[model samples]
Target: MTDTPDTLLDGTHTVLTPEYVEFRFTLAGIYSRFLAWLLDTLIVMVGTGAILSGLSMAMMVFPGFASALGFVIYFLVDWGYGIALETAWSGRTVGKRVMGLRVIQRSGVRIGFYHAALRNLARPVDRLPFLYLVGGVAALLSGSYQRLGDMLAGTIVVRERRLKAPSAIGAAAGEGLLADPLFVSRVKRLSAEARELVLSAALRREELRMEARLRLFSALGTKLQELLAMEKPAHLSDEKWTLLVAAALIPAPGARTSTGARAVA
Candidate 1:
């Protein structure tokens, strides 16, 4: 068990990745989690109402199949809903999005389909002894505020802070000529996901603590280094290298780009 840093406020935990980059995540407390869950339940109820109405119509027409169809609808609305939305929205259901919350892997990356499935599948177990009594206790006692499913699935819920400034490639300003055209090409070749990470790190750079910032950039820079197939210059901070990559990747004006760029398109 990792010790929670003294500097951290209550309900916050730090994750140190393999790249030695450490990030602080604020664990979603029971109150907020309950609120988010309540919102989701309401959504599920609405969906259930629609399904029930349809089922009622179907039953009147074909009474023999009513019970089975009703059961199927019940299962789907109760279970399938979360799985579908979380997977599709990258761990954000309608409720989570509204509440500014997200489910992510313990390591801080986005959760995969398998992770989503595993967590939701374990939902029944979490509800043991009624009203999430078992799960709530587990979360209250756990270091990372993990319920049984989250622990089993190696996932956690965290607060998703909205960036004050756009955390997009085009928002980053270039300094002088780019480091190398080859590097620029490499940056261009980066996967959309990787680029998003770089953009996010750059935009949120000012918000991170010094140690946390270094770790994050170091980790991201190392990954970028591998993609570029070269070592980063020692003098330039890891973050600077990441920013440089962002700048290089940003298509200049006359370029339509996402992340609030002035490009046409």
Candidate 2:
């Protein structure tokens, strides 16, 4: 998947997958990225300090060992913080969450540990010559606002869209069905992981081979039907049925959690 240069003027990065499933993202601006970085740095420092403070008594016993242990603690906190959180939280660190930002692969999917590590490992180079100057120049030149780390990692920081109700889910009348309080209530009870699966499958259905797609959706539709104790309409395909569930699970505005970026995670 790659972005077309024609769509860059508005700062939108569109990925057209091999099977033509498309995704769009608004690239994070430098100011917002910087702020996110600042917040994350402070948090890292605080966390590192707290851990070190607990070892104060150990330091008195062995000054040399304490210095070495301090370095290790700093290293783990500095490196492990982003890697662990990004992998677990679907590309969001605490600072990124506060700033409404997320890191995603160029393929428009949630970042894995490899992606997180690459980006975090490159941060030193991005900070080269002081204060993220290298990274800033790279972002300015890249047009999509990607830093050196992002370029190396094949990932981009993006502004998350506000959660909104789906009007339709693949020709199923989601809006109309959502009007039924019982239907909405049942769907709202779907676990976050299940809802994420439903949406991710719907969004990427075009990318799967036909047999795989059919089998996958059929199983999901059957399981979901059983769980929700609801019957699919006689005419709706399994894929369409799954899409309907996906649409129903999207949270309205002001909701705390999200269905994720194109149901990424």
Candidate 3:
């Protein structure tokens, strides 16, 4: 694998895979997660309450002991159900699916039962003293939306929904771009700050107006030039843009042509 530096978010250092960096969340992700949680909790509570009520009625014969048993059963069913759903569906509980949030491994892989177990198990600590106060603090401190349990489990919460595509990048295969050896290697080698800047800039591209975009490109170009310590090209072109990006990831010994000898900035 490539050895790129970690990305910093809100002062936290986070190592990122191309997929993770590329798919970074925005305000929409936060809203989606909240909605999903609300829906999922409502569904689970209603379902569980109905079952528990029936169990309580049946246990009327042994009031005290039966009530205790019912409580235990409820806890188990709720926790187990959530775990099963998240593990099976890659970090998505019913609520998350509806809201389009998902849990994933730090490496950007689908979360499995083991990882899910770790995060769920830590829920007690995260929720202690208040409604996820500890967990919230951890998430705020984390580069990714990782609560205490997720951090310990090496997992992250991410947006399931895709962002609006950047027109400049076109509709090339996302997988193919990430899979390129040169791209992967370069990404792996970035410093956390630089990586974060790159990721944030990429994600924000569509939001930028023309002037802002030009300004950003110029700033990025300057930063890249400093990073590579290369001479500035007499003129900038699309090929130059591609090469600069490539150069950020890999060291090109000399200029090479795709079909024609296009000049790269």
Candidate 4:
């Protein structure tokens, strides 16, 4: 099923999911990214400082003219440190980690060294025309918070929020529904195209026509209940099936009230 951000419920503040590409960076996300960046930067700075100090001391032991090498050593150290840190850790430098943000691929995947290098290398261009205007405009326009460098390199900067329990349940429940022995066997026996159609229908419920929706839901509900009765997973809670279905739809992290409203994280 090809899910899109438009399918998400309006005013529904759910946990971020792989299917939901539109990440809204909240206050907490900003703070977290900042924190992560700070931590990383401090580590890099200390390491660089120590290495440069040692190099300077070694250079002092050479002839007087050797002092001219200090500039070259300084430039090399700075360039190496910046590139290594940015590439190794994605777009996050020390500052970005402190802000709770990490650079990733647009598909919510980890970025590799090449993508990181491309974005970091373009940082100067992104800063042109005052106030990172180019980068800001790119981020605002992109589906994810991808700037010009990110677009060129196929990467994005996203807040690193922890997945909530409900989010996990949402992703797993789709598989759980088809896990029944009879259902599994039947699905497995179908042609690949038929199997895809059935699975797509189940996952992307909104795509079905209204009549189809009713028929599919009723039949699937009955079949699922019967299957559950045969060999229920011991760890499955006794919560109402309807509630679980609702929770699956409106997934939010952390515990909620009896009314199913989310509390503060």
Q: What are the TM-scores, per candidate, against the unseen true structure?
A: 0.74, 0.66, 0.51, 0.42
Better of 1 and 3 by TM-score: 1
- At residue 175, candidate 3 shows an lDDT of 29
Candidate 1 residue pairs that clash: 21-215
Clash-forming residue pairs, model 2 = none
Better of 2 and 4 by TM-score: 2
Candidate 4: where is the Cα deviation over 4 Å? 1-43, 61-94, 127-145, 167-265
Ten contiguous residues minimizing lDDT sum, candidate 2: 1-10
Kindly list the per-residue Cα lDDT of model 4 for residues 1-265, writing each as its tens digit: 3433422311112233322322232222323433563565466567666766777667677757455665555445545655676677645566665664566555444566787677767766876796567876776565554568878887655544443334433655565644456644543344433332233333335434566555555554444455434433455432223223333333245546332221111
Those runs of model 2 whose alpha carbons end farther than 4 Å from true positions after fitting are 1-10, 19-21, 62-72, 167-234, 237-242, 247-265
Instruction: Give the alpha-carbon lDDT of every model.
Output: 0.73, 0.76, 0.57, 0.49
- Please report, as a residue range, the 10-residue window in candidate 3 with the lowest summed lDDT: 4-13
Candidate 4 lDDT (Cα, 0 to 1): 0.49
Expressed as tens digits, the lDDT of each residue in 52-95 for candidate 2 is 89989988889889878987888689789999999898889999
Give the runs in model 1 whose Cα sits over 4 Å from its true position: 1-10, 61-68, 165-172, 176-189, 203-222, 229-238, 248-265
Judging by lDDT against the true structure, name the best candidate. Answer: 2
Q: Which candidate is the best by TM-score?
A: 1
